[model samples]
Target chain A: MMQEPQQAREAFRGGLRVPTSGCCPGWTQANLISLPREFAYDFLLFAQRNPKSCPVLDVTEPGETSASIFAGDLRTDLPAYTVYDHGEPIGQRTDVTDLWRDDLVSFLIGCSFTFEAALLDAAVPVRHLETGSNVPMFRTDRECRPAGGLAGPMVVSMRPIPAERVADAVRVTSRYPAVHGAPVHIGAPESLGITDLRSPDFGDPVRVEHGEVPIFWACGVTPQAAVMRSRPPFAIAHSPGHMAITDARDSDFLVP
Target chain B: MMQEPQQAREAFRGGLRVPTSGCCPGWTQANLISLPREFAYDFLLFAQRNPKSCPVLDVTEPGETSASIFAGDLRTDLPAYTVYDHGEPIGQRTDVTDLWRDDLVSFLIGCSFTFEAALLDAAVPVRHLETGSNVPMFRTDRECRPAGGLAGPMVVSMRPIPAERVADAVRVTSRYPAVHGAPVHIGAPESLGITDLRSPDFGDPVRVEHGEVPIFWACGVTPQAAVMRSRPPFAIAHSPGHMAITDARDSDFLVP
Candidate 1:
């Protein structure tokens, strides 16, 4: 068990490969997305326009490996990375040092894991955690505001909470706006054009028990969906569920 | 008096040049800084690093005439614009339609005016508004975190609040973090390297009453200071005290 974010990053840097979900319990985890400098401005605009789905934590200068939030070398620090060629996944690798480019710009986006922790702390049960499965994510029919060449449906991560605890969940997560914040939709997945709750486009679907409501929050995977739909020349992202554990604590993002 | 933000923008678009202070009272005002595309990423990163000094409200795509938050044409909507050539102010114009370039990227940053209104609403006396003087702004000794070719000292706006209402002023302003937020310093002009209360680097000085304490909040003018020091080849900004009245309501920025 990694006790600190730096320890987790150091282990990853030394060639250890593992998902970062439970590591460094109180620290914040970030979603990674790197793109060529040419595509950076448009993507930044996309994140700015759809802030709920793509709450940015840190953005590096073109080709810079380290951001203020994460001091490790980005090329080798993450547990795993998925490389995309014109929106198609070309390969997944534990280290991307060989593929590093000076013109590539990296964005560190806030992850729902931070808010999930808050939800759990508030006594709102997280279904996926109990079942030991990935949180289910779906592509909604709603279109995000287009920016330059990027456009796609908003992707949302869903969790099952007791109907009575819905308000508590919203209150807990609302304090972490840097992370997805509050639920985008509750109860009716069909309203978002999600035909079936058991079959998600990304991540594993968890069981929805009796009296539990399906609540969805804007997912950080949103930018990846945009990348796939828009087909940027090249891009890279952390494998779903695998994240960069940052030095910042979950409380660092909590608003008063 | 313009009753709506659009009306104020229309008046400016029609060449009515005047400071935007007190216009569209319930609307949010923004500080404009249009830079060539070459400087966009660095400036964006600079804003990310120094969020308090430069809270980005909206960023337009290269050469975009308007943003979602401000539906008016950027080239002619603002009351006045100061064009800069290698850091020096070349001219102030009512319209920049002729100088508008395809690669110019505009950043609409949060202005202190929004929180000032909040402060006034909370019954926290604002000295500048009472005296009909521009808020005094000073370049502080503290340097903002530099980002890729942009480096300069932080600039702060000073307000004199009654010593008893300082806590109320802080609470009211803190609710609107998007607009410079709470006071960065309270009751100490000399602490920020501001030599004298009467002599400010920018804007007009106001009298601090016997029972009033001078409070300082991060100012939007910090970016202009960076442009001056970094010497970017070209830039455009709102002339001092003249702002771009945005369509977003002041309430839209209030958190919690």
Candidate 2:
């Protein structure tokens, strides 16, 4: 039986710590990041300027744990979290209830997992999912638009698709603008200053078959990258692949 | 001869005060609203929650007078501005330079003027444009999703389209989601709590011809309505239809 988003969140709240890739199949999964109130404005402005890389799903008011999209307690609902201090990952925890502060502002960002399902449903192969590996992510030469004190290079995830299915993948994913939308780069990674396909900056490299071409889409990890570089005094983010499964249906973000 | 966005701003900077309709025809015009840094987060969140009512085009840093979308000095560029003290209109000015402050954050919201051109291009008759009157806008009974310190009813602008051409209007305007996309209600004004079409809360009402139906789209004046109701300590907005001409072209916002 497929677990509902609430059930999955309950399990996590009860201390189930694991990656959330295939959990709650039809529901939307989101990347979670919390920053102190002092830095929330700069980060929000940064997301506004670089929308493709940082498609915001929902934002919470200061000290609030839940948003309209995710009704569970944000401090304990996710499988795993990384606590950051001045840009360095200080530690990982299953829950951060004790460390949560009154001035913390949480942001839920759209994740590509929503569109990967769309791609597969449209018969476009998602290599990473088939191989049971994390998608390949790379830091590119392109700099994101700077806002206030936050700035960083854009990070993108790559998927290998048959040349014939590239257009179909673009069409299917374009409908979900809330989740990174269409390919940022269709082919030739070097144009974006990506030197080697085998060595990605983050995640596992997947097999690119003979007829397959590498396609890139803006990654949700971008805000984390910015946090890592900008080094704000305090921040919290979901562990790389462990996301928060929200109550929103996949079709909610789809546009006609 | 047509004026470029820069040229239009130059004229406004030189004290040309008038409604911006039909000015810089192909360029996009945006509604301007500036508030103190204290209220910026709540308003940005309000916009995020109610995207249909507030399609953000660009937002400037506190004290910053320009954005990438609008390159001219915001303090002196727009034709006219309305200053508010605790939400009550205090005065109107051609240039806000004397009143500008470093902690003031400005938001550029998408205007229906962009999609109105698209409607005209699709051969949909725009009654207000034809009759040389302002577009009719009303405060709907429906409430917008509230954010901290900001809450109000949704506001909509009405245009009467020939019954047969209503579908075409929706298709054309839906492509420009940055501006208010598609009509919220079609045919009946009373359904939206608007008792009469002759008198509107804002703008001059136009005659609805026979065989035509009234269509309502989310209006750019919404943020102003929110400001009026929320009663922020200080606020500045474009004098109704007197907007800031942006460098972005209408086609820039059209999605496939």
TM-score each candidate: 0.94, 0.95
**Number of the top-ranking candidate, with TM-score as the measure:** 2
Error of 2 at B28 (Å): 1.4
Clashing pairs in 1: none
Task: Flag regions of model 1 displaced more than 4 Å.
Answer: A13-18, B14-18
Evaluated at residue A150, the lDDT of candidate 1 is 96
Per-residue lDDT of candidate 1, residues A1-256 (tens digit): 7878888888988878766656677899999999999998788778878888998899888899998899888988898888989999898898998988999999999989887777778889988877767778899998998888999999998998999999999889877888888888998889999999999987888888899999999988898899989999999898777789888999988776
The all-Cα superposition gives candidate 2 an RMSD in Å to the true structure of 1.9
DockQ of each: 0.49, 0.56
Tens digit per residue, CA lDDT, model 2, B32-133: 999999999888888888888898899988899998899999999998999988989898899999889899999999988788778887889888878777
All models: lDDT? 0.87, 0.87
